[model samples]
Target: MTDLLARHRAVLPSWMPLYYAEPIEIVSGSGRRVTDAAGRIYLDFFGGVLTTMVGYDVPEVREAVERQLRSGVAHTSTLYLIRQQVELAEKIARVSGIPDARVFFTNSGTEANEAALLVATNYRRSNQVLAVRNSYHGRSYAAMGVTGNRGWSASTLNPLNVSYLHSGDRLRGLFRHLSDADHIEAAAEDLREVLATQTAGEVACLIAEPIQGVGGFVHAPDGLFAALHKVLDERGILFISDEVQTGWGRTGDHFWGYQAHGVTPDLLTFAKGIGNGFALAGVVGRAEVLDSVEAVSFSTFGGNPISTAAGNAVLDYVLEHDLQANARRVGAILRDGLRAAAGRYPIVAEVRGRGLMLAVEFVRPGTVEPDPAVTTRVFEECRARGLLVGKGGLYGNAVRMGPPLTLTEDEAREGLEILVASIATVSAGEAVACGVSA
Candidate 1:
């Protein structure tokens, strides 16, 4: 290990996951590419865990932050009026699809979800939360409590009573044999059963991601959440869509992932993209629901001028450039390419995800058993070929790719080629060793 790696191991928590056997320190980036400490350029398919939405060094975002820096004002507590914060909140509310929407900004997705949970439990006067199996929210106590993936959930102790429901993963669920429509009905029925038995029927909310991010881009069938929402509605339970990974039109089919199910959440939490790598996240909900938080609360640096300025620029760029449409178009190309690769590679058990947020699952040939060995091999191969991706799922046997929404068709094809080549190399059982290159 390098001296820096040794220092990282010494200081950082052991549970903090790193990508490679020998991790590369990314130094700088432009567009969809990053250069590591050793001056090796790699196509960044993961986009810093989907936070770098527009791309690295985007001119508009840079100029906006630079302008804010020139103003000689940066931090002002949320107690004071901030123009950029208000404007950004307005934009988010407008796009949030919640009627009479209100927004509360936070510094990260974990805080945003925590705020959402606070609003939800307070509004409904209950602490029981419904979550989906194989789902991931965030790492904080409340967030981790709702998270269903065992790998991400660090402990069994939880702040709230959380009941896990079928997440609609067709590939690996009790209803995997059923058709899409039947699967939705089954999952909805499962939700009803869970609610009836698990709680006292006074649940705070059902928190879900339209697409499970850290769980290997697992997607519930379309309209599944809507079906479950009908049950929650009768019980007067709120719906909180965790859009930390699915927002900002990253899914391509809709600006918000919940829209694909034709449902509007009572509350939504977002991060990882709006500020294009800046620490900005928030909860958008109905005015009444947000107002339910009676205590005076404030975020010290949540909506500070600099982060809000970056957010405004990112949103403007997303709208003006129509990156959502680009994500749809190029993402289709990448998805088709991956599916085709799956056909060719026996280890590629599945290819899934919507738009740019995609994943390829590695499994034993002709079986659904996860092949994490092959997954690790393919990951190292991609790294050796100057491509950066991500890994997740309960078994850690999937490769995830969520390039910037601004990824061009050519870049998509290039990254796809590298990915397929790496998979092929691993599938061939090459004896190549893993680790960072010198």
Candidate 2:
């Protein structure tokens, strides 16, 4: 290990994982690529786990932060009214789509979800919460409790009485054999059962990721949440859309991933991709839900001037540049190329996701069992070819590709070629080891 890595291991929590076996120390980044400490450049497909929305070193965001630094204090502790924070809140409330939407800023996705849960449980007067299987909200005491991915069970800090609803993974769910409409119906019924038999009393809320992020970019049917929300609505159960990864047009079809489901959430939590690379995240909800917090509330580091300034610029850049439409166009190119490649390899069980958020799920050569070994090999091979992708899955066997929304057609093709070669190399080697063609 390098000195920096050795120091990192010595200081950082061991549970906090690194990507590669020999982790690259990223020293600089610009556009859609980053340069390692050794000065070798690599196309950054993961976008810092989907936090870098536009790209690294974008002038607009950098200048915005610079101006904020030159103008005033870095933080105001939310006790005093901060102009940038107010401006950002106004913008988010306007676009959040919730009726009479209100915004509360937090420092990260974990804090955002925690805030959302706090308001929800207080408003509903219940600690019982429901979530979907294979879902990942965030990492906090309450957020971790709602997470349903078997790989990440409720941690020791879990406090909420959370019950999972149903598996949302169409490829590996119990309803995998059903059609989309049928699967939606079955999942809705499962929620009804959870409410009837599982929950002790009035449930607080149901939190879900429209696209399961850390659970390997898994997706449910487009209208799945819409149906589930209908059931929750009847029971006075609030619905929280965990859009930390699927928000801001990353999913292509809609500005928010929940829109694809055709129902608006009562409360929505977001974090990643909002400030590009800055630490900005928040919860937007109905006036009543957010206003339910009667006590004094404010985050010390949440609405700092620097991060809010950067957040404003990011929203402007995404809208002015029409990056959402760009994500659609570019995402299609990447998905098509991957799908075509998957057709050639039985190890690739599915190519999933929308817009710039895409994933390739690997399995045993002739079966549906997850093959994390091959997935890790693909990750290493992609790095060798100057490409950086992310690894995730219920079983750690999915290669998630969430490049910057500004990814161009040529970049998509270029990255796709490298990924295909890496997958091909790994598949051929696996075949040789197994004494059969893959």
Q: What is the C-alpha RMSD of each candidate to the true structure, in Å?
A: 3.2, 1.1
Q: Compute the lDDT for candidate 1.
A: 0.91
Candidate 1 collision pairs:
none
Q: Given candidate 1, what's the lDDT at residue 297?
A: 87
Model 1, span 305-345: residue lDDT tens: 99999999999999999888998999999999999878877
Please identify model 2 stretches exceeding 4 Å from their true place.
none
Q: How far is 184's C-alpha from truth in model 1 (Å)?
A: 1.2
TM-score of 1: 0.97
| C-alpha lDDT of residue 283 in model 2 | 97
Give lDDT per model, in order: 0.91, 0.90
Error of 1 at 98 (Å): 1.0
Q: Per-candidate TM vs. native? A: 0.97, 0.98
Query: Per-residue lDDT for 22-119 in model 2, tens only?
Result: 98889899999999999999999999999899999999999999999997689778888999999999989988899799999999998999999999
